[model samples]
Target: MSTTDSAPTCPVHDFNHYAELPYGEKIEFYDRLRDEAPLIRNEFANGHYIVTRYEDILSVYQNAKTFSSSAVTVFNPNPTFKWIPEMLDGDEHRQWRKQLGPLFSPKAVEGLEQKVRERAIEVIESIAVRGSCDFMADFANQYPSFIFLDLMGLPFEDLDTFLHWEDEILHVSGEPEETARRRTAATIAVTEYFRTVIDARRAEPRDDLISKAIEFEIDGEPVTQDDLESFCILMFMAGLDTVSATLGSTFYHLATHPEDRRAIVDDPELIPSAIEEILRAFAIVIPSRKAMADTEIAGCPVKAGDMISLPLNAATRDEAVFDDAKEVQLDRSPNNHIAFGAGPHRCLGSHLARRELRIALEEWHRLIPDYRLASKSAPTEAGGQLGPSGNIFLEWDV
Candidate 1:
C-alpha cells in the first residue's frame, strides 16, 4: 500500500497521451496498455505511472487523500495556474462544489433542455440543406458553444474569439516553448476578457451564470477576483471544449457504423442509450492525479509527489468490468461506465453535458438522419485533456 526504497518495478511504456494518433488507435493503445501490464511508467515528460485496470483506477479516484487533485495534468505536474474547483480538494473543494451545485443541478439543466435543443436544431438546420458541411465547424462545435455563450450571458458575436482562445489554451501544438507561449498568451487573453465581464457585472448584476457566481462566497468571505478569473478560465475551457470533442467522437462512430446510425434513426428512443454506449466505447478523458503520500496502486509503487494517470477509456473498455466491453451495444442496460468519471470529483456538469449530447443527437437525427464522412476530405483528431481535435466533416443527401 506504500512505496519504499526497494519498491516493485513496473514495465516502462513510452506512451504519451498528448501525442496525436488516429482516434481508433487511441482506444487500441489503451487496450494494449491494459493487456500489457497492470500499470506502466509512461516515459513522457517526467515519467508517471499509468494505471490501466478498472478497479485500480477507480480506487485512486475514490481515495483522493492518497492521490490528490492538486495536479490534474501529467505534462505539467506542477501547473503554474489552478483550474478553480477542479484543482481544489477537501473542505475547500466541497464548499466550492456546494456553491456551484445549483447552477448545474438536474433541475437547472432540465430547465435548459429546450434552449439546448433549440440551439442544436438551429445549428443543424443551417447546414441540413447544404448537403455537405464540416460537422465540427458547422454543427458540433457551434451547437454547444452557442448554448454556453447564452448561459454565461456572453455575446454570440464573440464566439470566434472564444474559439481561438480555446485552441491556444487547450489544443496548442508545437515545440515545447512555443506551446507554452501560446497557452500563456491565450490564458492572459481569456483572463482579461473575463475581467471586463466581471467589472460590468459588478456595476449591474445580470441574469447569467457569471452574475450568479459573482455572489458566491467561501469561508463567509466573498470570492476573490483571482479565484473568479480562475473559475471563468476553467468554465471557458470545460464549457466550450468537452462536449464538442465528444460530439465529434459520437458522429465519427455514426458515420463509420451505418448500422448503428440506422438503429438510432429508426428508433429515436435509443439515442440516450446509444450516446451512453458511444461514451463508454470512446471515453476520451485521461485524468491525472498527484500523489499526496507514498503509495502503491495494484502493486505499482508510487512515491510522494508522483503523478498517476487514470485513463477512463481503459476503465470503460475493461473486459473484467463489462460484458462485451469492446463492442458498442446501443441497448446496453445498466451501463455503469465512468465516462463522466467516478468519486467525489466526478464532473459537476454531467447533467448538462448528457442533456446536450442527447438533445444534439435527437435534433440532428430528426433532420439529417443519414450522413457519412465527406468523400473529399478526411476527419482529423488531436490528443490532449479533451480528446479529438474536431475536424470531422459529415455530408448527407439533401
Candidate 2:
C-alpha cells in the first residue's frame, strides 16, 4: 500500500553522523532513531533512507519491484563492483540462482560440515597455547579464510594478500574520494588476481569448484571469462568479510558478557541457539537498495535514485518485534530476524556462516572458554558488509 498525504512525517535528522562514534554507541544511536521514526532521511553519503524498524525493513525487502538492489552500498555513490545475485534483480537474479545456487546451497554447505568443524578446531588449537592473541587475526579471520579456501580451492599461501585487500576495501577512513580510490584499487588488484586463477583453471582443470565453474556454460553457450570473474569477485566480497565480522562481534559479546558466555559454556547444546541470537544482535552487514520507482516507505515519500539503507543490523533490536530487544537471550524462541536479509538476495552463505559460528564458539569454549577484551584498542565499525572491528584483541588464561 503506497502511503499518500496524511502519512507519518519523518522526525530523524543528522543521525548518520553516528558513523563517527564507537560501534556500540553507534548501535545505540540507531535504536534511538528507531524510537523516533521507522523511516528517517539521511542527507549524507549521497543522501539515503535510514530504516530501523523491523517490519518496515521487511516491507521494503519483500517488495523488490518497488526497491532495487542496484544501489547496494550507501557509502560508495559510484560502486566499484556489480556483485552478483545481490545486485541482479527480477528474472536476471533468478536465472543466476539456478546455476550458482548449488555452490552455496544447504546440501553443499552440509557436506562441508566436517571441514568447517575441523578448521574451527584447528584455529582454536593454534591460539589456545598463546595465552593471548588478537582473536580476529589469529583465529576468527583464518577460520573463514580456510573454509573459503576449501570452497574455491584457492592456495593457502595467497591468504595474506587476499586478507590485505579485504581490509583495505572495507576499513575505509579519511575523505570519501580517497577511500573510494583505495577501495577501487584493491578491487582492481583482486580482480586481476582472479583472472589469473581463471586462466590457470581453464588450462589445467582440477577437482575444485572453481575448475568446474571455469568449464561451465549458461544456457547453450559457454559462459564468458568476464562472467566467471564477476562471480569469483562477488564470492570473495560476500564470503570473506561477513563471517569474519559476525564472528568478531559474537566473540566481543561473549567476552564482555560473562553470563551470556556462561549460558553456552554450561550447556553445550545451547551453542546453536546462542549463535543465532548473536547473529541477530550483532548483524555485521548493512546492504542498501535504490528506489526502483518513486515509493513510500513507512508512509514517507522516497524519491527514485534515493538510496534506502537497509540496516539489517538494527532489525532484531526493534522493541515491538523482539522482547528485550537489546539484551542477549540465547534461548529466545521464534527468533526470526533478517540478519541474513530477505527475499531473493538473502545471504547465500547463511548456512555456512551459521555452521562456522556455532562450531567456532563451541570448540573455542571447549578449549579456552574464559577470556576478555584485550588491547586498549576497541573494534571500530567499517564497510557495508562487515562493520564490527576488523582487529579485535583478546587475552585469556592458558
Candidate 3:
C-alpha cells in the first residue's frame, strides 16, 4: 500500500532492494536515495522508514534501547526466527557478545593469519595459473568457506553443500512466495544440520568454535539448545557470506580501477587501508531496528513497533561525514566508517573478517597482481540485501 497523506508527511520512495541490481548501479542507487532525503518512508515490501545520513544512522545505532533489534529485516517487521546475538538486546546481547568475543579477538585472528594466508595462496595459485577464472567461485567463495568450516570443525568436504544452503537462504531468487519457501526450507536444513553437530559436540567435545560455544553459559544458565542452534545458524551465515561478499565488491573495484590495484600491488602494506576504503565505499549491510517506543528520527515520526531500515552504504557515503565518500582511496586514513555496523549488535566476526580479507588481498596481489574484468559487460550480481552475492569473473595473462 502506498502512503496516504494522513500517514507521516515524509518522503516516500518505493523500491525493493532485494531485487537484483548490478553492483555498481546499486551503489549509485544508494547515493541517489541518500541525496533525496535524510529520511524516506520506503514502501517497498512491508513499508519502513529509511535513515540515510551518517549522523542519523549513527544515532539510531547508538541509541539501541530506543531502537531495538527485534526485527533486523525491513521486509519482515516481526521476524519468525532469531539470529542469536544480533536479534538479542540489552544484557542478553551483551552476554552473547562477551562469550563469543574472545574467539574473534585480534590476537585470536592473528594466530590464524598464517593458516588464512596459506588457504588464500592455495586458492589464488590454482586460479592464477589458469590465467582466467570466475573470481567469486574459484577464490573468493572457496577461501572463506574453507576458513569458516575449519574454524567450526565442520567437514571441508561439505563446503559445497554449505554454499548451496547459503545461496538458498541469502541469495534466494524467485517469485515472492517461492523465495519465502526456499528461504524457510534452507533455514530448516541449516538448523537441523547444526542441531546434529551440537548434539555430537555435546557427546564428544572437540577443540573448535562449535564445541567451545556448546559449553557456554549465558546469564549464569547453560545456553539452551534453541539458543545454541540460533548461534550456529548466525555463525554459518556470517562466517560464510560477509567476507565473501565484501571480497567480491573489493576485487570488483580493484579489477576495474587499475591505479588502486597497482598502488596496493606496489606497496603491500597499503592493503589494510585499501580494505578499509573498499569496505567504506561498498558498505553493503542494511541493518534494521524496531522502535521500542514512539520516537522522532530526523524530525520524522516513528511509532513503537515501526521497523527502520538503516543502510550502511548510505551512512558510509554521506557527503556530510566523509570527504569524497564515493571515491575509494587506498590510503584513506582515519576511516571511521561503520561498514561492520555500530553499537551493541556490531558484527562479532569483524577481527576474523579483517584478517581473512587482508590475507586474501596480500596473497592475491603477490601472485596475480595485474588482472581485469574477463568480459566487457559487468559481472553478474545476485543478492543485494546483504551485499552482492558473488558471480564476479576476472582474468589476466598467465
Candidate 4:
C-alpha cells in the first residue's frame, strides 16, 4: 500500500498515511488497516496511534478520561487561545456543552430549517441556469458559510472573507512555513474580529450565539473573555467547515451514482437515510486526542501523553457493524454511523448539519437529477475532517 509518505520509519497509520491519496485509495488503505491492524501506532510527528475497528474506536472515544483532548492546542489548553468544550474534559467539557448545546439542540435547529432551505435554494438557483459549475465552490462551500454567519450574527456580506480565512486554517496552501504563516495570520485576524464582537455583545446583547456565549457561565461566574473567544473560534471553524466538505462528498456520490440519486429523488422521504449512508460511506472527521493517562485500547498498552487518533472515518465502514460496509446504500437502515462522532463530544452542529444536508440533496437532485464527473478522473478526496481538497466539478444539461 502506498503510504502518505515514504519516510523510512513512518508507520502506515500516520496521518500522512492517507495523505496525497485519492478517495478510493484512502478507503482501501483504511480497510486494509481495519482488517489487518485495527490498533496501529505510528511514530510520526510527536507519535500517535490509530484505533480503526468500530468497537475499538468506540472504546477509545468512550474512555475520554484515558484519552484527553486538551493536548489539542487548537483552542483550549493553548497559551493564548481557549478552545472551549472540545478541549475540556470530564465536568469541564460537560459544563461547556451544557451552556453551548441549546443553540444546536434539535428544537432550535428545527426553527431554523426555513432559513436553511431558503439558503439552499438561493445557492442552487445561482448555479441551476449555468448547467455546469464547480459545485463545491458555487454551492457547498458558500452554503454553510451563510448558516454559520447567521448563527454567529456575523455579516452575511463577509462570507467570502470568512471562507478565505477558513480555507487557510483548515487546509495547506504551500510549504510548511507558508502554511504555518497563513494559518497564524488567519487565526489572529479571526480572533481579533471575535474579540470585537464579544465586547459588543457584552454591552448590547443580541439573539446570536455570540450573545448567548457572552452570557454563559461556569461555576456561577461568566466565562472568561479568553474562554468565550476560544469557544467561539472553535465553533466558528467547526461551523464553517464540516458541512461544506460533507456536501461536497455527498454531491459527488449522488452525481455519479444514478441509482442512489434516483432512490433519493424518487422517495424524497429517504433523503435523511441517504444522508446517513453518504455520511457513513464518505465520513470525513479524523480527530486525534492525547492519552491523558496510561490506558489499554483493546489491550494495546498506551502511555500518558501519547496521541491517540479516533478516526471515525475508518470505524463507520467497519465490516463488523454494517453489511456491504463500503457500498453507499441510500436505504441503509439502523445505520448507526458515527460520522458526527460519538460520546460527549459528538458534533454539536449535528442537528443543523443533518437538516442542511437533507435539504441540499432533496433540493439539488430535484433540479439536476442527472449529472456525472465532467472528466474521466474521479474528483479528489482527502481523508481528513475538513473534506476534499479541490473542486468537484459537474456538468449537465442547462
The C-alpha TM-scores of every prediction are 0.95, 0.92, 0.95, 0.91
Candidate 3 lDDT over residue span 1-398, tens digit each = 22223135477877766676666776688798889778888776667888889999999999989999878876667777899989999999998889899988998998998899889888888888888887777777889989899989999888888888988887766566778788889999999999999999999999898899877898799999999999899889888888888888888889889998999999999988999998898887878899888788887777888788898999999989899999888898889999999988888888899889999998899999999987743554445533333556788987
Q: What lDDT, from 0 to 1, does candidate 1 have? A: 0.83
Q: Which prediction has more favorable lDDT, 1 or 2? A: 1
What are the per-residue Cα lDDT tens digits for candidate 4 across 14-46?
445424455557666778878866677664444
Error of 2 at 162 (Å): 1.0
After superposition, the stretches of candidate 2 with alpha carbons farther than 4 Å from their true spots are 1-8, 12-20, 76-81, 375-377, 384-391
lDDT against true structure, model 3:
0.83
lDDT of 1 by residue, 1-398 (tens): 12223334577766656656555777788899898788888766667888898999999999988888889877677887888889898998999999899889999999997778877888888899999887777777788898889889999899888988987877765555677788889999999999999999999999998898899989989999998899899999888888988998888888989999999999999999998998898887888999988778888678988888999988999999999999989999889999998887999989999999999888888999999987654554455333324666788898
> Model-by-model lDDT, in order?
0.83, 0.77, 0.83, 0.75
Clashing pairs for model 4 are 4-16, 75-82, 75-83, 76-83
**Model 4: residue 44 alpha-carbon error in angstroms:** 1.9
Backbone atom clashes (below 3 Å) for every candidate: 0, 0, 0, 4
Q: Which scores greater on lDDT, model 3 or model 4?
A: 3
**Candidate 1 minimal-lDDT segment of 10 residues:** 1-10
**Which parts of model 3 have CA positions greater than 4 angstroms off?**
1-9, 382-389
Residue 271's lDDT within candidate 4 is 90
Candidate 3 weakest lDDT stretch, 10 residues: 1-10
